[model samples]
Target: MAVARSRSSAGPVGYAVGDITSLDFPDGHFDGVRCERVLQHVREPDAAIKELIRVTRPRGRVCVIDTDWSSSVANGFDHLDEDIAEFFPEDNDPAAGRAIRSRMVRAGLRHTTALPVALRFTSLTDAGVVVPFFNCGAMQSRVRAELIERFFASVERSVDRGGLLFAFTMWIGLGQVPLGSMPRNVS
Candidate 1:
């Protein structure tokens, strides 16, 4: 953070890294907040969302964006989806993205909305820019060696056939804090 601040041209910037489940700021401090791609790794995503609401002022907006790995697909390869899902790191929630809006609604945030976005890639080289699985070594989960070989071979075939297609859904969820309301059970 210090490195970023030093390199930045903006003046008088402040940076604080606090626990998402329990923010350090006072209640209703900010006009808007955005938590992006962080909830999937959280042990209690709901609590984190509530904390975001707690720190947002009334009529403020909170946006949460996350990826649902279960929605990942690589067409032209039969085992691609299975491989990606099975080999994905367990610490991240594969279904967390799709659930963000529903969790916000359950937290009593008004004017809730969910937007589903699909990211598509047709080549391994291009896909590697965003999806790390294409590079193989970036995988954190344990997968069978033979399966990896087969997966790569299939990918090669797909690439040769000019049919490689990879896509996954990432959700953008939004909600507005109600007038004079705090998230239930949140201070």
Candidate 2:
């Protein structure tokens, strides 16, 4: 990858890595692209989606994945799970995950699908560590109750199913380029 990037960057400003909307490379450069958890953060997600499509070869493929907090499972939340909930409040909107599927197809891609996958690790004991990182919170509060409960439940379920761990869903979207449109600038 480094050698490829170096070859692509022939000058001081050659290796550009900033906005996805205006990629440094020319149109139809890459054969495959992966936009993971990136489109949602962009100010103009639609434009970003167009850029991803524009940069790839017409016959290539693009794989996009994001987390959908709205579709999060509640198999384990409860009053005792307050410690877990304090970190993950449902107040914040997860627009990126919710909007990416539709946006990918609208950008002119030929196909799109949402494949939800979950990972559960039971060996993790300090819910505090994982909660702060995943839930995006500090201490405990009613607002974070849901998050806490979910974490507890997920942990319990992980154990019941197997052992103590963390689990969350991942939404995957796939699209293909149009035939006969080979990329031009990317190696």
Predicted structure with the largest TM-score when compared to the true one: 1
**Local accuracy of candidate 1 as per-residue lDDT tens digits, 71-157:** 887688666766766655666686799999999998879999999999999989888767756767755355677777888888889
Show model 1 residue runs off by greater than 4 Å. 1-15, 86-92, 135-137, 140-150, 184-187
State TM-scores per candidate.
0.78, 0.57
Those runs of model 2 whose alpha carbons end farther than 4 Å from true positions after fitting are 1-16, 74-95, 121-132, 135-166, 180-187
What total of clashing residue pairs does each candidate reach?
0, 12
**Global local distance difference test of model 2:** 0.60
Task: After the best TM-score superposition of candidate 2, give how far the Cα of residue 22 lies from its true spot, in angstroms.
Answer: 1.7
Please provide, for model 2 over 1-187, each residue's C-alpha lDDT reduced to its tens digit, 9 standing for 90 to 100: 4775767745643344668777876778888888876654456667777777778888788888876544443333333245423323444334467666787777667877777776443443454454333333444433455555565566566557654434556678888877875433222
Flag clash pairs in model 1: none
